[model samples]
Target: MTAACLMSTYQPLALSFNKGLGTRLWDQDGREYLDAVAGVAVTNVGHSHPKIVAAISEQAGLLLHTSNLYSIDWQRQLAQKLTRLAGMDRAFFNNSGAEANETALKIARLHGWKKGIEQPLVVVMENAFHGRTLGTLSASDGPAVRLGFNKLPGDFVKVPFGDLNALEHVRKAHGSRIVAVLMEPIQGESGVQLAPSGYLKAVRDLCKRWGWLLMLDEIQTGIGRTGQWFAFQHEGIVPDVMTLAKGLGNGIPIGACLARGKAADLFTPGSHGSTFGGNPLACRVACTVLEIIEEQHLRENAREQGERLLTRLRMELADDPNVLAIRGQGLMIGIELKQPIRDLTMIAAREHGLLINVTRGQTIRLLPPLTIDEREVEMIVRGITRILKTA
Candidate 1:
């Protein structure tokens, strides 16, 4: 932190972790902390997982990068796994969630051209977080993120997340010009908000009726973070386009944009590309991450542990006057406070030896590893209760 050479885009926590296991981390002071944040949901199978470590070690000895001009076998395997899980026809790998979304938005524009619309507008929900890039930022719901960046990418229309009537209104007014609808299955940045029940199905029907593509952002909720492989699976309907990252590579930094049917054939060889994308190392590691998630049954663990955590939190904090709301699904969880307790992050670390995060100022976000055990769930419940009670 004292190094003046690095730019200060992030205000990192005071303590640095030296080692990690399943749900535990040891800091520089040798203080053990329960990592409920789980590296912000990147380590789905857990830190230093034996399989993940071995995969990394083996692939590093092999080929790391050979450029996209040639074919990558691991990349094809990773895409095959993702497409099977996502129920999409094809996938394109990128380095991060932002790039995944950027790919999705670009595909939307191309689909618009096929629909005979020159300036196609994609409808996005409010209070959603896509990414930091300008194209994704323009589609994002946060005004603060897009504040300094002027001239955002054009043809993006905003709509209330859970409002079906407002979407209908937009369709009524600008029916021909709108080419796609982009949304998160669950709004992660806006305090773990769930779209109203039947909202996604309704939107799917609407898109089918009007010939507009349905693009779902599953970067945070994909890869078994939710009980299902992807959050959209809960609704039992497949989307025209879907983007994934985060847990996909278990911290190796890989993302994929998937498409089905007509959307699948939209991109040609020269139309879109990435140099470091779909490299052997990242893809092999991602394939191992997926295998471990299934082998360990972390998806079921996410369901049971997440349910227990939420229920216990509600039971513990229900009587507390400061708690406003508690809502979540699977491992993606949140509890909103009546007041802004921004400093609670430090307090949780200092007092309870727990790593957690606060989003939207007042909402405490819990994105623990999907492999959390019953005992660790109890620990998280207690740690969060202490923070909420004292704050």
Candidate 2:
């Protein structure tokens, strides 16, 4: 009942939730709060959705897990569904976004090795967050996450986000040594920083010109969080490699690394694998989550509600001098303040009865469920605007 035995990995809030449904959560004492975080963009379909719960329950009752040594029907089905949606040819399942990204990194390395590059390099974007693992951390550009992790693998080249010239320079400098480019379509942890218009298409063209795999870390922006099934779709482009997790299983631990063209064929039998990656339970649940998103038309809901929330928040906070910028795509919104307020999360929770997240020191990040309704969108806009105004 206490945190005595847990690791000191997180300085958690002083609250615990006992129940959640849709965009609302109830603390142990039954205090209701609106959930704008969505488990940091994991629960896209919302908390304890009936369909998700039923899928989990049913899958658990049927089968939980079997190692990858054997064939998993649900896993194959999930792979088919995900790859079809992502416009990729193949998928490799994993346990989390970090592992999925690790898979992509390995693919990049192998793709380079096959082309006779001794030490392959992956170009990563500044202020991008891939994951916490060593490989993913190396691909990421966050100082705090990389600090103290001494002597990380140095095969990654860092470039500024949304800067095409920086990428061109990397190409000119690194050239053939660069095997792939890994980046989030929208930088989530550093705040919801989107690339410049047409930046992704330009990057894709650059990758084609340089023979580098275009890898997109869609862990945060995928699975309908950005209105589209994948954020890259917004630009009418498909990445050579895409990593997915978070909302894929609707809270179940599962990740996927999808690839196409030469990148798809790089991973062979012994190249990479995971024991519990695409177990029956996880894959079935993921399939169910995708189904629910489509059946309920949550993608359209996210688009409409996201526009409503963004417009309302902009209108409400536009006059505030402290509000630096208000920007978002679909449900992934961020409100950047002029100064860092580290306790914004605590304040939002305790004072306004809202669950939110503060990222990159000053940006208030919102990843409400894709199923959020118009009324809930208004509530979020009001709650967040009040916090910004009164803070």
Cα lDDT of model 1 by residue, 1-391, tens digit? 5358878677777788989998889998899999989888898888899988999998899889998999899999999998998889999999999999999998999998887898899999989899998888988877667888888877888899999899889989897999999999999899999888889999999999988999999999999998989988899999999998899998898989999999999998799999888899999999998898888888898999999999999999989998999999999998988888767899999999999988888899999999889999999999998887777
Candidate 1: give the clashing pairs: none
Cα lDDT tens digits, model 2, 69-125, are 899999899999998998899999999999999999999999999999998999999
- For each candidate in turn, the TM-score is 0.98, 0.98
Q: How close is candidate 1 to the true structure, as a TM-score?
A: 0.98
RMSD to truth, every model? 1.0, 1.2
Candidate 1 residues lying further than 4 Å off, grouped into runs, are none
